[model samples]
Target chain A: MRSAADAAEPAPPVRSRPGGRTARIRTQVLDAVTAELAEHGYDGLSMDAVAARAGVHRATVYRRWQEVGGLLADLFDAAGNQRWDPRDTGSLHGDLAALNHEIQDSFTEQPSLAMALIAASFRSEEAARALRRLWDERYTQSEIIVERAIQRGELPSDVDARALLIAATAPLYHHLVLLRTPPDPHLPELAATTATLAAGAGAFTR
Target chain B: MRSAADAAEPAPPVRSRPGGRTARIRTQVLDAVTAELAEHGYDGLSMDAVAARAGVHRATVYRRWQEVGGLLADLFDAAGNQRWDPRDTGSLHGDLAALNHEIQDSFTEQPSLAMALIAASFRSEEAARALRRLWDERYTQSEIIVERAIQRGELPSDVDARALLIAATAPLYHHLVLLRTPPDPHLPELAATTATLAAGAGAFTR
Candidate 1:
């Protein structure tokens, strides 16, 4: 059976520590998995390929990750753990527009991690749940933007944060990802401005 | 080589002409493709499986479709030919809400054609391009809702129909598909209202 240490993230440690070795190996394996996923997508991803790419023993990957689920779970967990923060642009429109730009960039870039993970979710139930949880966390993190707007008297205090946030960003994804349209440089701000104006007019009140 | 009759869609045929045979075969093959995609997805889809499912000869399937790309292209073409039109609810709010409900239902239904095709697009370039064209066609058809809103003096005459329509429906997809959120009964009306209000205020004016 895998030990608790194996199931949990290793603590920060010096190179000589056992935890450091575990951390190092985990980083290498996850990085390899990311590279494989980006280059060939979830269909081409395999434990053997990941092991070879990481220069780790195949048996180790099999024993630890067990199969694709564990690998994907960890991959999504790593993403959620990243130091992501909403840009504080001193106004709701600026913050939302900046957030939209970040999302736009993520999907438009070649071999995009955002696109890879979203596509993987379609094929794997485990991956789909993981992505759902990740979005939950992201939206939770971004709720502060709405709170800031309310505090600044820019939006009604009772505006539905989730509804407004979805409005401000959904256009970019709708056009680029679903419609596969060329990125319009004006879309990010247009959507944000629309949402902000609507919020100010009490359209998104809960 | 396949005959020119086999290369194009048969005109409304009475089932006795050569084109009738071609049209019949095409319908069987495309129906099988949709069934295979809904049940097994793109990864499990194969020309052999499609042939067996359709009760057609394997060699005929190979001769006609050549590969998955041909199958997807034809499937999308069949979808584009359907006689679909936006609801005429006599007001911007009613029309937008009705359109949102259609989108919401399409994705919520079990073995959803909408969800299946969207997921398939992520895995195949041909499927992706076909989906884009299908969206382009769908958006064009739905544009009349905005035009109607303008003629009724509910929105500015110059409102960008594409942008307004995208805003009206995007929240449903963003929440359901990307965020994997549970179906919100009120989201359809809420999103439509937000977009309609914003459009009336000239946020979507070109």
Candidate 2:
């Protein structure tokens, strides 16, 4: 496998612990894997290829990742780190719109990255499992924002925080995969509108 | 290329009137293409395979689709046929929730089919293009429902219809791809909440 670290753009380390030899090597390998995923897409990303890209022995890479699927799961989670914090914007619409815009920019800006991961997930159970890890981690962070909205009475107490969060991000993906268009610049506006529609349903106060 | 059509799935016969023999063969080829896509996805699909599957000469398949991408565009349009009449329900929340639930159900009930199409979309530019065609068609249809809500004074007229639709659907895709989990049953409630929140936004009512 080639050292893929240089081939693909660097993704944020998902759960790396700093200052350890083994951890550092694993990080190196993961970086390589991510680079390859970005460059080659899933069909072309093989364990052998990743090892070569990382300048690590194929056996060493295999020892860590086990299979192509496992490696993908690890790298995907590592790359898709959700680092945003939702501060109180004091308005539900603004908060949702801001979050929506940030997320939309991340996905749509490098759509191929999202597309590759999505494609890989469909083909490999491992990729799908890995993607879930990222989704949940990010969801947890978003849940905090929704909870705050409830606490402030900006939203209904009964609204399912998780549901609203999902609704908030759904449109950008829909625009890309289904609509086959670049997400609109008005994504923040869209998020606010969705938040309003959901609120009208009494999801917020409930 | 293999005939993926379920023998039981009847092909709508082409009317004799219209484009004559050329049209008939084109329709047959497209029908065959749709069945193949449903079965094998885009990566496994090729013109040679299509020609073989359709039992038509390679020349005929080539003469029509010309490129695999073009063929997918045709099939994508064919596959996306979602029709739901708007019901005022007086309560926009309940109405939208029901719609969100239905869309989520469609994807969840057919994981393999959804996966195949989504995967195919990533591999082939044609498939992606075609997928977009279908998505836009559906989006347009769904927008009518939201538009009606605004007219009824149940929603703010300024709310972005496209955004609301995306928020309603994004979670389903996220669950399918990242979570690798079945869609949540609570999607309608989530959709309702999001809608309500958006409609309540200060920017919405004005």
Candidate 3:
């Protein structure tokens, strides 16, 4: 029988790469953690378990992440930085629709990332800090789009850009995490509708 | 030293009282758990810590919630079920504004509930399930307002009621959770702006 300590030791490298073996191993372990999180959740997550899953030593995980919360923060940063550059769709509606499509795909395609980050936020201060970091990044990124709309006169000069952005995607998370439903196809439309409303509301103008 | 086995024992009677001393203990423990969550966040929360805080036996906390996940679920349920009977403001905007105010207060005042649940979700399947249950209750409650508007003919008959309801509250959560911002004081004005947009978009009619 394996003692908890045995599961926690560091292991030899998994993939031999020409450059940055350390980075590669880190990626592999984080990937393993993400998979385990999708399957087992946070309580089930352990350095020992992650080590076994990643084929890395428990010591390796501990060395890299320092703690489970630290490991998750790195994973969340990687996930949040997953990209979708905005296209010049010429119309606010078109750009918003495109943006919403990208988000919908992100949510539908890689649910584990969302689930894991959300789960971590509840249990770890480190995870909360990491999550808040991602949240800020997201807000900043989305604001750029809304600001462009304002400049283009597709939106009011006084539009509540932050409010518009929140109205757009908040429901999807709400549905996935809270309501336990796959977000509806019409969600993007509703989001666009809300953004357009906020843009024209001129709340920011006052 | 307290072994895990010892912690697993069924709780003894906490005290003889009306409303079942066990139930009172349960409530006390739950309140302690909630307070701990609010003060320290999920990572800082521990069953032993919660027991110590509540002045109850560690066995009592474990027996009631079963695990950190169970404790979170019960807390999630309690907070989510904090009900508000909607007042008839005789207009869609008025009703929505009022609802948004209540929601803003709920999350802003008790941010720990959100933080704990998110952290727990990372670690426990049961916590995720509990979160979803609480959310379902909120979604259903919010929908009632939309239905009321429809019944009153303040909006067209053919609106996507579900979408409308989601639109109304999703932004509130988005600001709280994602943006980490306290909602604007003029939330009613914001809601009114949305109602105006909905009316013009013929979101319900079309």
Using lDDT, give the best candidate's number.
1
Worst 10 residues of 1 chain B by lDDT: B1-10
Task: State, as a TM-score between 0 and 1, how close model 1 is to the true structure.
Answer: 0.90
Candidate 3 chain A least-lDDT 10 residues? A1-10
TM-score of each: 0.90, 0.78, 0.69
Give candidate 1 misplaced runs (Cα > 4 Å). A1-18, B1-19
How does model 2 score by TM-score?
0.78
Worst 10 residues of 2 chain A by lDDT: A1-10
lDDT by residue for model 2 (B16-41), tens: 32677776776667667656766676
> Top DockQ: which candidate number?
1
Instruction: Please provide, for model 1 over A27-118, each residue's C-alpha lDDT reduced to its tens digit, 9 standing for 90 to 100.
Output: 77877877888788888899999999989999989998898767877777666655456889999999999988888877777766677788
| lDDT sort, best first | 1, 2, 3
Against the true structure, what is model 1's DockQ? 0.73
- Cα lDDT for residue B187, model 1? 90
State residue A88's C-alpha deviation in candidate 1, in Å.
Answer: 0.7
